[model samples]
Target: MARTPVLAAGGIVLRREAPPRFAIVRLRKRNEWVLPKGKLDDGETPRDAAEREVLEETGHDVEVHEFLGTLVYDSGGRSKVVHYWRMDAGGKPVRALMSDIREVDWLPLDEALDRLSRGYERVFLENVGPIALQAAANAERERRTRLRVAAAERRRAQPAEQEPAAGAPVIAGARAADPAPVRPAVTPEYAAADAGEVAGREHVVEVTAPEAPPSSAREIAPIAAVVQPTPRKNLIERVRDWLRRAA
Candidate 1:
């Protein structure tokens, strides 16, 4: 069986500030600050592999912003391509594990350039650094724009009041400004529909008369006593009585 190409991934180490910064991890044996990366597993894309590798190596979760570039170099006569990305790590860098990563640190833009391996520095400066700077600039511009718009709205709502001069317009245009009109209070009739009383007070159309009290025993007629006839004893007794009468 032919050996499969080793797919790997990792991330740019980040420095947190008003505008974030990027750096790389220093592997123990290699002893170089390079972008955190590892090989992809079966069915894993390079992007997913990169994110996982960065988190594993750096202990920093990051949002991948964009693909920076790719590195294609020969490894043992087989070509390997390492995909790079610009990411936002969202906070301070902390060293989590010591086995794979010896130490993790945040370097300023210029200092990061000094620390990264010469082989990868070209990629960092040419691709990743510029992209990160542009993103930071864009974020700053958006922040300033939002602040300006909010300040303008505040000023418009409540402009500074001027001291009244002897001949200055008496009301300062304040009274002339119309107050927001108050809506009239709703009456019970208008609200009655929502209350399920649309038929207006459910008028008792059929006023049934109250039932009379049950009659007392004194007012009721007495029940007559019931007399039951005595039953004859047997057929023999009946026949004897009939014969005697006949005789």
Candidate 2:
């Protein structure tokens, strides 16, 4: 007949630091340094037990996150199964450490693994440590993203300050300021339409007509030179001229 497995739970508690750290505890009885975990109380769920044990051992109230994994091994003659979750510890400790825990040490993953008294626990940590660290990093990135979004929202909510009008009055002794050129806000769609209209439209130019000459100046005709004609002699004048010539 197979025996029932002894159930336990804990956390890979992460502390916010320069490079981040994990929490481990020293047992009071055996002086064995191990991950913060304990056997589950009756009627308690694994999740709740994990959070409770981590708080008691590490003395920092942690926000429980995703389930990391479970470690199954032999403890004394019975099978032991320990469940773990990713937990984030912030600020200072809210409560004192439990009597079962002698002390708590926050360390980097490699150092924490080396400090553990049990080989199985070390192997478990080696696998899950990266998972916990990644969760912490993701949480931090989310927090920063939220802060940026909040800042952007605030900026959008505030009223924009009015700019001074172009060609503002100059001071008595100050140099006259040049007016800034006003550019129309043209969207790409509008710009394309404007370009098409300009290209299709015909160019119109205006020309001034020359004035006609006055009537008085045009009425006068050109004058020609006059000549007198010699008169023809009558019969009496011809006879007189003949008698005179004969005399």
Candidate 3:
């Protein structure tokens, strides 16, 4: 005789948080903490049964997202097969009224893992835990991306009005039609300094005075350099001229 499989369904109900949390309830028959589940009603689907059982046992509305596959075990000389899913405890919080449950509460993943007595239940958590955490991470990444896009759009929509720093070099912004010229800071010393120009042929302007030519030499030619004329008389001659004038 072929043994018939017992159909049951449940979920790993996840409350969205940093690491996420799971719901655990105590069974009245065994008095052990287990994920909330119940047997399938006649002609009911596994997904429906899982959602229905989760709500009925935990008294919280749940949204079933992904089917987490099934686990088969031996119970009372028959195969008790249960289908599980990854469900979200979505939206705002509400008061959870217990139905067909004893002492139900939310627990951290590690605590929930320790509370589950069955190896199959632990296996389900190990599989679904990473999935739930990864989902939360993806949601956060999408949210940040949306914020960045919004910021960029806002920048594009607003007009640019940034003032240049004080005493900084600025290019003229007005067009040829406007003709508004901004004056630059031009110090006197900077304008007169060497001008950085190349020299013309045959002549150079000397920056300093040169020695006077000897008194014996007369009628000199134009030199290669243009120089300031030195005082023709000696200091002793100038002193004697002043003395004679005083007398």
Candidate 4:
């Protein structure tokens, strides 16, 4: 019987960082250290094969995120093509070796490119590195942005500072720079519709506070009649939140 041309699938499994590193494996019999890839099993898709091979070879679970490209090369007289994907390893490689995988290493992309035994693979990384680096920078920026936003939210979510005791004397201009407390978060759907923007575009809210009804149109309630807000629960609520997140 005539042998078929080779078909394979693999991944550039990353353990996410500033520069992004990839998982590499070495075979016990072979002196080469290369990406973890293998021929697909019967009835398997390229994505499934890639995920499965990485787990089997490196003992690490991963989810494929981006498709890199396909590489075609010759092995003996047969033509072989391997599809590559950019995968998130979820965590560090556990070195869970099956019968085939000998040693696994996580290396910086640039270093991995040089350490990889195949020129074709190195070239692939060279071409993909710039795009990947930009993505990493963007992700890092977004993460920091989220942390800042979360802090802002926590501050906003807090109840306004407690009023002084009923009999306490007011000091003129105490904490005057503290802005008035914000009311509520805008619903995402409203925000989305307000901007009518494509993905990655932000909605600029143009809130025109209803023209201050001339003083004559306003109801002047007695200052003492204003309902005082209740004091909010303190660290206990935060502890509950921390416990919830931990769970």
Per-prediction TM-score: 0.52, 0.66, 0.55, 0.59
Model 4 spans > 4 angstroms off? 1-4, 17-19, 164-247
Total clashing pairs for each candidate = 8, 0, 0, 0
Q: Write the per-residue lDDT of candidate 3 for residues 74-156, one digit (tens) a residue.
A: 88999999998878885554545454577676777888989887887888787776776676568669989999999999999
Q: Candidate 1: count the clashes.
A: 8
Clashing pairs in 1: 7-40, 8-38, 8-39, 9-37, 9-38, 10-36, 10-37, 13-23
Scored against the true structure, residue 207 in model 4 reaches a CA lDDT of: 29
Task: Compute the lDDT of residue 169 as modeled in candidate 4.
Answer: 53
Worst-scoring 10-residue span by lDDT in model 4? 217-226
**Every candidate's lDDT:** 0.64, 0.80, 0.71, 0.72
Segments of candidate 3 deviating more than 4 angstroms: 91-99, 143-247
Q: Scored by Cα lDDT, where does model 1 land?
A: 0.64
Candidate 4: TM-score? 0.59
Clashing pairs in 2: none
lDDT of 4 by residue, 1-247 (tens): 6668789999877777655777889887876887888998899998899888988888988867678888888888887789888777767556568787778888887789889898987887778766656665676699899999999999999999988889975644435454443232332222221222332334333323334542421222112222233343355565676688879
Model 3 pairs whose backbones collide: none
